[model samples]
Target: MRLPCILVLFLGCGSPDQVQPEIKQLNEIPLNIRDKTEVDERTATVNDTLPEGWVDVKSLIPELVLDIRYATSDNFVGIQLYPCERCLLRKEVAEAIAVAFEALRADNLGLKLFDCYRPRSVQEALWRKVPDARYVTNPAKGSMHNRGAAVDLTLIDQNGHEIDMGTEYDFFGEKAYHTFTKLPAEVLTARRKLRDLMQEVGFKHIRTEWWHYSYQIKNYEVSDFRWPCPGQAL
Candidate 1:
């Protein structure tokens, strides 16, 4: 069954209450998408090595751009939090994102992922640095990212340059809020296009962050499993 659409409209007020209803609906929605374990079972014969419900997105969508900020020091933390640069998500979420990419590609646009499927341990470490819930969710409570069902990404143009979204990824401020509309007209248009496309593909946007989206059709537990780093002992 197809998931019910969750439309998020921003009024440029930066009020969390405006987005709370959608967030609440995310948990209340009945399961419409296939379970991750089921997907794992079906794909087991095709590729038996990957963990159930988890996939490296680049393998499924090769043309999609990946700039995993946490794997490098270019993020807000200014530290390499991840072991490597890879975009991993629950199998269903990955597939949905791949479809979104195809839609974007048809328009000569593309996606550039910043972060995905963050390990719970990493969340704890991040909390240690920034304990405030405004910026980092407490690891004890966990986040959609810990469940391999969330993504931080932005749109890229045909030339592969990231389209302006008012601020850079991981910018924790009012300026990063989807309701903040004092930016250039082009930036607003880019953000809306991305938001509309992602929501159409079963993803929901949070109020505070323009680049973050979480798949809502199914729920998964927070995980501590870390992806292997290149040339590093597991």
Candidate 2:
């Protein structure tokens, strides 16, 4: 379903260049903890030990491939948003994704992740660059990615070639919408297979983006913690 424009605007109001100052102000705003149970239930307590309930997808499902476009300048923004090319997701969501990967494996296929678990700060940077609700979600409300409950992904064949999905990942147009038909039969079939597998494992597809899906069984808090990058001094 389409997110309400008013909500998008209300939550994501500033421009990209203004992100630093806005982030400073946002930090002053305390998290609402009245729903402590909700936070406790969904928030993964991460530590150096690689705690339970939150995991790096690559480690858990080695066969699943990662493109992690945000880690490079190939994305629409033309800026490297992530310091590393790691796919982090809540434990349950990661497990469900693993299940989907196994399902695809039966057909000699695998899953390729484009994006996952985006930091809230990066969301602000994206807002500053795009500033359009049509393409990017407002950082104020936080997206499912920020919650570690969503993923942008596609399917790959046994040879590791990407299957056609009508359009490339992050294509900002109607052609990328799941409802936009008018494509080759193979492309449509590929999209259907991906959607069916994701839904079967409890992920919900957004109508506007064929590659995007959010886990439906649980909720999570928006997080600003950035993953550590390689070569950084401890």
lDDT of each: 0.76, 0.74
lDDT of 1 by residue, 1-234 (tens): 212223333244233233433222222333222345754454453334446767777766667899998898887678998977988888878878877777776689999998899999989888998898977889999999999999999999888999889998988898988877788988878887887677767788787899999897799989988786545433
Q: Against the hidden reference, what TM-scores do the models get?
A: 0.80, 0.77
Ten residues in sequence with the least summed lDDT for candidate 1: 23-32
C-alpha lDDT of residue 41 in model 2: 41
Whole-model alpha-carbon lDDT for candidate 2: 0.74
How many angstroms is residue 36 displaced in model 1 relative to the true structure, after the best TM-score fit?
Answer: 22
Q: What does candidate 1 score on TM?
A: 0.80
Cα lDDT tens digits, model 2, 1-234, are 222434323433222122221111112323242235654443333223343456777655666789999999999889898987889898778877867776666699989999999999999999998888877899999989999999999999999999999999999898988767788988877887786667667777777788998887789888877776544421
